[model samples]
Target: MTQVNKALTAFQVPIIDVTTDEAIFEGEGWDAVVVIATSLAEIKQDEVSLLAAHASQIDFRVGKSATLLFAPGLAGGRLIISPVTDSDNEYSDVRIFAKAAREGIAIAKAAGATKPLLVVPSVTDNRFANAEQVAALACGQELWQPLEARESKSLQPSLTAIGLLNTATHSLLLNAAESGRVLARDLCGTEPERMSAIGFAQYCVDAFADSGLAVSVVDQVEQLKAQYPLLSAVGRSSFDVARHHPRVVKLEYVGEGPITKTLFFAGKGVVYDTGGADIKVAGSMAGMSRDKGGAAAVAGLMKALSILKPKGIKVIAELGLVRNSIGSDAFVTDEIITSHAGVRVRIGNTDAEGRLVLADLLSHLRLQAQTAVNPQLFSVATLTGHVVRAYGGYPALVENSAAKKQGVAATLAEVGQLWGEPFEVSRLRPEDFDKIADKNGAADVVSSNNGPSSITARGHQYPAAFLIKASGLTETELAFTHIDIAGSAVEGDPLYGKPTASPLVALLQFSN
Candidate 1:
């Protein structure tokens, strides 16, 4: 059998490794050079010493200063000096290093350097050493080329760490960045078919083919109708309107030994959500392509884990790939549908299709866990705009157990401080579940209640409750957490309000 390569060829961070003895400035062909200093003495002795002629031109006292100087005799080459404080020595504090790297890359780009060099003087400190590579990866942001056939103008820069370079640390940083690059490309790229439900499943299957993962894809509605009616209903709507089919992609990673715990991750993969028969306004449907951010994240996590090969814990991912488009065949408001878990659901609004897809996927996962020894569930989705309104640019986390919730919250908080991807914890109250109950003898429960009495502002919780019920697990029986990444998945910037592929760093850190 021919093996499929899951490795990404586009949007990769090009890293050039250099030994300590190599003089970074020896090459006359270089466009620019970046020198990072930890102390004032190092700023004067180590960094500034290389450019003694222009030492007097720069004020080296300020921390985090990026000074661009021209070398007169060296054919007008540019040199950038960035300073760091002693307090920023915490290796665990990724922000300090990432910030310094971002500054270095910005300065290099401004100097018109297609291939600049980064030099960190104090490499004995692991933080400084890691910072060099972090800067190189951050420089990737400048060199990033989206999925376009057009030629890219981005540059691939090199770096040199003065102290002993930890090869393992360098590999880890590069791997993490590579994983992130795949996500960014998937989220930000403009491939409508590739981002579609069926296309996304194909992407996952190709990606994990050679990664030792067991992949299964259910693409037709007929195959899923009896077992996953909710998912089938949502996906069938897009068949006539968008000519897109839905699919459920499952990936499993099992270790050699007796697996003690199984981790199941479900991502809502509504490739293009047009709010079905209810329909979304122009503004609401403008960026509907990003509705698959949750599945993109899951694919990214599985990619990283496949490379990292974490032991003992088996990982399973269920990506529910479907499109909710409006047409005569689309599921509409006030329609009743029986889910795979045997729960009768009334479609209060067709826009609430993400939870419906997840409901069936989670139900399947619950059944899988019955045979497995110990199982923990996690669901990620861009469920509602209410979460974006409440948290602005942060993900809302809802966990069944308070203790487990606090632990994950604390871990995520620490990771957030370092990575700048914060998540807020939302309560999964009993009233939330009570509201989803068959109130008017209409159905087992309403899929969504966007009416006046409905808790629309706290809409993130309602879906969480509905999913828990769909999973066929009591809140106390299984450990489950829901992550609503509606706001954090995309950038808030006006000009580039694109998908950011967030929480990848946080999730990777938590898994570690």
Candidate 2:
């Protein structure tokens, strides 16, 4: 057996270990300089202005694409200018800077520069307050390679460190967030075998060791089956295989100051979703490993919280990690099962397993919220294809009545837009509850419609209804939100794309 390499459990992305400098040319030992701006003419820095002036005279692409120019006077005899487009419009937000910064960093890496200084022009506009930080994070996003690629190829970090020019002291925060995102990408984008349920739990345990967050992993078959019946049902077929058994990782963070807000998160960590008895056909299961993205993001969020140690807030997360494998013991459709909350649920479709896993976890969180301070509940999952059909590359938030009244989704959507992770606010209506109603009247609710969520009407929206009912929070006053990241968890190809760590940044910013 090839010895497995242990993952770097901390902030290991060297490129994101950022530094801030007031000037671009002062001998910070930077190899190359990459300037990202909406309008080059507005920048007041003398050295950047001189480089842009010279570059504009020689190449027309200076302010258009990532244009690299040779200069003898600059830090590394090279200058890369990237432009942010359409940032002045009503719909445009701070992501323009991120997009341009990614392009600039890519060009710098391709140019063989190990230490590039990023010059992001800070804007006074309220909308772009965090533009500099967003751009820096974008560079991290662009430079990050997949965990498998790094482990198999024995890849080393290409860029040593990044310098942030004319920006606030955000290195600590940016590095923390990027570190969380890196952990998220690694967990969400890895192969099923590498990130099996037990493996995932072990990773979290190792990552959070001595981080001050109380972490516990529950792997006992009897304990899991009793505490998380719905989640256990999804993993029943895989239980016989010791390496494939399910796990529930519980994480809690308490700030030093008096608690002002309490947050409870339930993450659906389906390590591999073969779709159970209702299996996905025609290569649909190729990227089923990414089904654990929600749990991965939550784990990453806890990591950031542990590092930052923000005050006055308490966070608790339960990640239900399981593999929806198929076998004689696999739970099938039409089977009636009682949830942890004591609500009877009929398996409308075995493929709709994420919600079942989340329902039980959410039920547990709901119980914790009863005594929490100003509590808010959220269940995150890549649960349905209907979200992708509805909003391409954007996560959707479905809030119950209590959360809607509190503008929970609206606030998250606003924060997400500015941080390069956008969200679409979806409403839960009477029709949604109706859709999940068990027609047979044999159970309290149905997991999902038998048809594909991409074709079913209100497919993504109705799952929140089932979650609310099955979790025993149907008429509760607690603020509860159901986040469906089916569309935004991965970028590009559905099977082989990079995990974007959707809503992590948004949720992090909103929590702050």
Candidate 3:
């Protein structure tokens, strides 16, 4: 692999190490210079004296809102002056500054500059450092340009901190950027086959083979069918050896000594959803390749855990890898399929295949928790369009424990604020399950209801309710939370809708 490929696959950000002693305009020239200021007045002073020298040559003005100024810097280099705060606030928030810095990088890239210098005028506090680091990472992401057949170049840029730059803060920025790069690549890639169920599983195995992670693969249809009928049922349609078979990938991260608490993470890995036998319309299935976003997120979280390696907590990530394709043997609606939990499920809509796969895997996790100590189960998936309609790019969080709901909500909010991955808390009412019970009177559970309307109208609560029941988790034994990232899985844009790879930072923060 080339250097660019290595940097991308290994999740390393393109950053060049630098010392504080280096002059801003010395040695090799830079393509652009990013100047961060609080106000235009601040820029006229000694804080940005370097840029102030050429302020008259280039029209520079300050405003109430964050703005960017483009001009010529020393030695024909471009200068980008970005303000983080307006007149109302003294210091801009980390997010605001980070965004401004990102915009600065975008402007520089648009102006045909590859090597840009980032200069923050603020005192290096925790907030300032965070914003600066986020800016650096965002800049690196903007610089990264990948191609399928041709060799790509690495995005290596130098960062200079005017004030004291802590070593720990720098390291944190580098780590976060690396993780973000992994997520961006997965979300932004255009290749569908590379992210297929089997293909993804192999990728995971390759990623963690030497990372001290115990990886297991279950690909044979018969073997999966014998163990997890629901998972096998959803994946049985595309069983061709040449076309890529359905599979389940399990990653276990056991800390030192006996496991005291087990955190189970199950993700829906429907590589491409043709809605099975139900068959989705043209536009509905346009980005169906992103169906495996849930699994991708789980994989991203696993990658973070491998590096962080928090002590005492054992993490098990189960990815339900499958392709919900339509074929002669595809599982259809109204079929009575028995789940691994032994609950008889009458499929109401084959389109609701994510829940079916998650149901079996969650049930298996519940069974494993029986012997484990302090087990907590958390499942992530883009299970419903209703969630997307309701939350619109923010994950919908549903937890079984009503009492701990507030705490969970606060934690999620904190993580969101810290990392920009926000989620809303949604309730799972009893009536949701009652409707499912009414539909499948003969069976223990109904995979879905009469139509998409019933599922969407209820805000996708039915699936969560069914999953709880299928997982064999009693209301009283509340230790589970379901994150519905249906709407939030991939960012909607005119170009390819990129996967957000959300809640990865949240999980990492919570684990720590």
Candidate 4:
């Protein structure tokens, strides 16, 4: 076990709005100026061009990557020029700006500057309409220190505030979204004991304090077992330990105006997945602590929506936080368990516990959708490795029949692409349903096949089918989307990489 220090606050970073070019040098206490653009020649702002030209003259790396130059006239006498490369390439997207902004912010932080003014010139390209916001968020993504690092004082907080220069996007909104991302990353990236099922719920409760959202944590043993049976079965072994008991954190937000659209989300928060009876052998379980990315991301969405307070939209979320530990009480393969929806599920593999957790949560959301106004339901989870194999570093959306009919997945994919959080739309096939059907009709559905999802055919798509059946969602035509964030949840090294908070921005933009 490691010594854990918890953060006292949820969001500590502040975003300041810089509306004029003069502010780059003299206004709002900015210490360093960071200009990120596709090309330096495209920059028409006189003040920005002055610094850009100066850096280009002294260093050849000016337009290639993140370049820092000594400028006496600028704030703190420091200027950093970050260029977005490969924008003109046939397959490039707006993520180039995100990559450059991260690099620029990194250099600024290393240079001992506390406040950096981020300048992103407006582009006529509709594809990059949200470039300014994306770059601003990229900076937050880069500067975010893990919860443990901050609590233990191993890594000190760097930036006091970030200046978004001459932009149309509101600073408050960017900060709101970044705040949620920070919360999401903290919840997803922490170690198992530090952010166990109970710890995760408490963090959310604290984060939502005075935020005008209805928050409740369901940890009563009998209550959770009655309401989330499938989820309980996953956490069965850990029930003996008070800290590791399963929790279903329920949250709701109703806007000021008449509700036109209602969104319900189910998040899979498997705090640590030891794979149960089908234990992850060899080195496969090193990064299992991050299995809760889905639940973390959904919580983040609600946090952002609470701050933005977009009218005519109502949001409800349920996070299934549990640990699948290997012990005497652990649920094993081929065991039959009834879900909260009363569907009989035969556990085919204990490692496939994330879907079980989601199924019960989605079942609850399905019931709520029955009486809601224009409801859209979604399940977000790091449910399978096949998604990573199918689409590397991109979340995949698998929509039910009703969602496909309404073009829900297509809409999210388009919005995500423009916002630099790209998604792959996966279809639900009849074969997927067939894969979950019990060969002997012994149970309503089989949880999963015995093989690892990364090696199984249609590994990622079939779970959506099982979720639909087990959750009894087929009883209605409500639009439901299962988002698989297995690959996109973390970047670079899967074991130690930073949580990317994928699909959070895309979902927020779509909700707005």
Q: Model 4, 1-512: lDDT tens per residue?
A: 11221342333567888787777775548899888988888776776687787778777788887888887778777888899888777678889889999999999999999988888888888778888888988988888888888768756568888888874647878888987888899999999998999999988998888788999999899999998999999999999888899999999999988999999999999999999989999999999999999999999998899889999999999999999999999999888999999999999999999999999999999999999999999999999999999998989999999999999999999999999999999999999999999999889999999999999999999999999999999888999999999999999899879998888999999997
| Best lDDT among the predictions, by candidate number | 4
lDDT tens per residue, model 2, 306-407: 888899999999999999999999999999999999999999999999999999999999999989999999999998999999998788999999998899
The lDDT values for all models are 0.67, 0.87, 0.66, 0.89
Q: Which stretch of 10 consecutive residues in model 4 shows the poorest summed lDDT?
A: 1-10
What candidate 3 gets wrong by more than 4 Å, as runs, is 1-12, 15-25, 28-32, 36-76, 85-95, 111-115, 119-130, 140-168, 180-184, 187-190, 240-242, 255-261, 402-406, 453-455, 475-478
Q: TM-score: which is higher, 1 or 4?
A: 4
Model 1 earns a TM-score of 0.82
Q: Write the per-residue lDDT of candidate 1 for residues 351-470, one digit (tens) a residue.
A: 888999998988888788767767778888888778877777779888776426446556666665555456788877888888788778878788888552124756787788888876
Off by over 4 Å in 4: 1-11, 26-28
Cα-based TM-score, every candidate: 0.82, 0.96, 0.83, 0.97
- lDDT, model 1: 0.67
Clashes of 4: 0
Query: 65-97, model 3: which lDDT tens digit per residue?
Result: 333444433322555666665424544345566
